[model samples]
Target: MTGDVDVRRIRNSSFLTWVGLVLGSWVGLLWGSLLFMPVGAGFGIAAASAMGGYIAVPLWGTFWGLTGLSGQRNKALRDLGIKVLPDDDPLTQRVGALAARLGLTTRPWVAIMPHNNAFAIGATRNSAMVVLGQPLINTLTDAELDAIIGHELGHIATNDMRRMGLARSFQNALVWYFGFSRTLQRWVRWILTWMSEFLILAMSRRREYWADAVGAALTSKEDMISALEKLHHKPRLSSYERHHARLMIHGVDSSVFSTHPNFLQRKRALEKEKYLRFVKKPVVAEEVLAAPVTLPLVAEMAYVNSK
Candidate 1:
């Protein structure tokens, strides 16, 4: 509304691009590794070491990646002074309420982590977890918190979480090449890290845009814009090292090849389109509706439908 609202169609371009990057990198890594596989095998360390590297990279990456996100959620929750609902708590009842209102199948898990960020990830439509940073919770108000949660829900609704998880899995598998410590191995890791960092950054940027659109669609563009503006007030650093102190939860150290667009780029996008143009919620309300009321009903329906 601020300018022209020429929303582009979801071309799946970003998804495809992510896939290509993962696959290409995997193939290159494997092919290059095989070259040294012989040397490793000659010492009888090739089969075990190469295979371990192959398997270990993805496994380790997935484990730590998920662990890092969980850490972020814990940090954010603590900072926000919000209670994390116990598995059987009445708040679980509210899951359906929020999900139905947001038009999602499940309510994303809201947790805190130690960074200044938020993200959503899960394999199934019903299994989303939204992790937020402690800094974000401490810094933003309740309305701002809602807007941020809404944005993360947007990621779940768009299935970006699942897609991103897969991309990360693939990238992790390819990182097996890093297990060896040769000049070429180091060089390859460096190059691949550079390339993966670039691609991940790009994919993250597009997903950020898409998620912004989603939040705007569910809540209101103004809320999203307000949230972004709130973020703008926080620190902004140029280099990866400079930003690392704040990005602990997402563990999105650009140095570590994690998924995240540059911070400034994110801020600009929110500003460009007037972030709140698409959301439906008013900035202020009598009480923040934590979740929708019909949550149980929809959950039941979803359960029945699965049958």
Candidate 2:
């Protein structure tokens, strides 16, 4: 049931991948442009400058927001107490290897946080970072961790992380612009924001499913499922954890507005996948095999020899 677009076979080869930052930047810019968010807010932030707030704020926010997201990525992450691993770290090496196997030209930084959730953040693939919960990391197997990393990398690869960042920013801007009103204008703004959030949450849920599929394909169905199952819990949220709840990988939220799908739903979806499977003979294209070597030919040869 897996389509070619949905399930990409892991590739270990790429000629253009090794050429350093110039080529990598080109690739990232292309990917980033492809997934770029719009530059308009439902509740406009008037330009305090010459340009009206409606026009200028979005343009301004879109520009610096993306730039700041990339430039301050490390600082922002560290502020959350995420311990970004060094390049020489074993865990980093393992994740880097997985990124290579997935044919990712720009691998993200691997970080650990003292929370019960895993999530990815960045404006571009070049600046992407995947943060894992330390508790999960200390307890899970290497393969399982790879599965988790693969899913987060999927977000980085598709640039969904940026889309999420912008969507949330827009949501907050709306709150600021409309927060003071007490009349119909305020109520209307609230309705629009609520509707937008509902739709965004739906998209987020779908992205989670796709990321799970990508992880399963990049690692193994078993590892992804195991990782999800192991990390699934009712976490006593710290202020930081609760603040970034929407970005987290796993949660028990079953509401229509929940950013993530139910854990059991994710598990069931994974149960149907044949991704990143480990087998003596990995499924290869039929054309790659020697078509002339038929079973009947072997049987005929054996019969003649016996005679």
Candidate 3:
């Protein structure tokens, strides 16, 4: 069953990679032709356009896609204020055990920072590192933390960071190609930017769902859902900010610019019995009604339970 899931995931990733390559190539070609036309007009528009599309665009896109603009290991760690965990640390132990369970031959560097979230970073499987925030560690239980770590491992296993980097490179190429313009070209570029954003965000949301499934596979459906609730309820905001954040949680604002799906939507998806059954887990909704004042009662309950 796990083997089948792995095969399906690999196939999906391959499909997305091909789609990104083709789309990126086309976008680059269009942008390259526009820029090259000014100089290439001496050779005639048709020839210049062909040269830009066939040679310049594909070469540029390929370089960016393969090399990647982000994923600099040192820079990422430094920016996040991440410090490596000692071999004996419990978190490090947990990470090692989890990596072994996931069949990762090259274990990811485990680090911690002073924030409320955890994420994975690396250009490839061999270089992957997982960073957990101090607040996240302090707030979540052992089981909850395991579920969250599973999600980050899922990102590494699925190569989401690399895929997103390639997509971002295409977006950056578009931005650079259009940055010089001021009038109609600038407006066109703005529209294209939004289009690229929508596509990237769509992919990001799907990746999150896939990661959630991986998390469930690693832990339990209940544990994954509880972790999500704990993450949602973790207190890091002021009263006023919390109120506004709640509105955003309900998706009052546009999600076009957001990367992850709304938490409520994610929880609902996890609640589905069909998905739980597929993962060979029994589905049992632990009902926690929302308070009149506070929107998500599960988060409140989770907070109380943790206390």
Q: Please give the CA lDDT of all the candidate structures.
A: 0.54, 0.63, 0.64
lDDT of 3: 0.64
On lDDT, who's better, 2 or 3? 3
| lDDT for 79 (candidate 2) | 71
* Candidate 1 Cα errors over 4 Å, as ranges: 1-22, 30-83, 86-98, 112-117, 132-143, 178-183, 235-264, 267-307
The order of the candidates by lDDT, greatest first, is: 3, 2, 1
True-structure RMSD, every candidate: 13.1, 10.1, 12.0
Model 1 has a clash total of 29
lDDT by residue (tens digit), candidate 2, 169-280: 5444444444444642355456646765786688688778777876777667788888888777544657776577667777535889787888888888788653323211
lDDT of 1 by residue, 78-110 (tens): 544544545564434443344455656456665
Residue-pair clashes per candidate, as listed?
A: 29, 3, 0
lDDT-wise, the better of 1 and 3 is 3
- Residue 280 deviation, candidate 1, in Å? 11
- Please give the lDDT score for candidate 1: 0.54
Comparing 1 and 3 on TM-score, the stronger one: 3
Question: C-alpha displacement of 81 in model 3, angstroms?
Answer: 1.8
Candidate 2: C-alpha lDDT? 0.63
- Assess every candidate by TM-score: 0.54, 0.69, 0.72
Q: How would you encode candidate 3's per-residue C-alpha lDDT over 212-263 as one tens digit per residue?
A: 7767777777888888877766665444333323112111224756566767
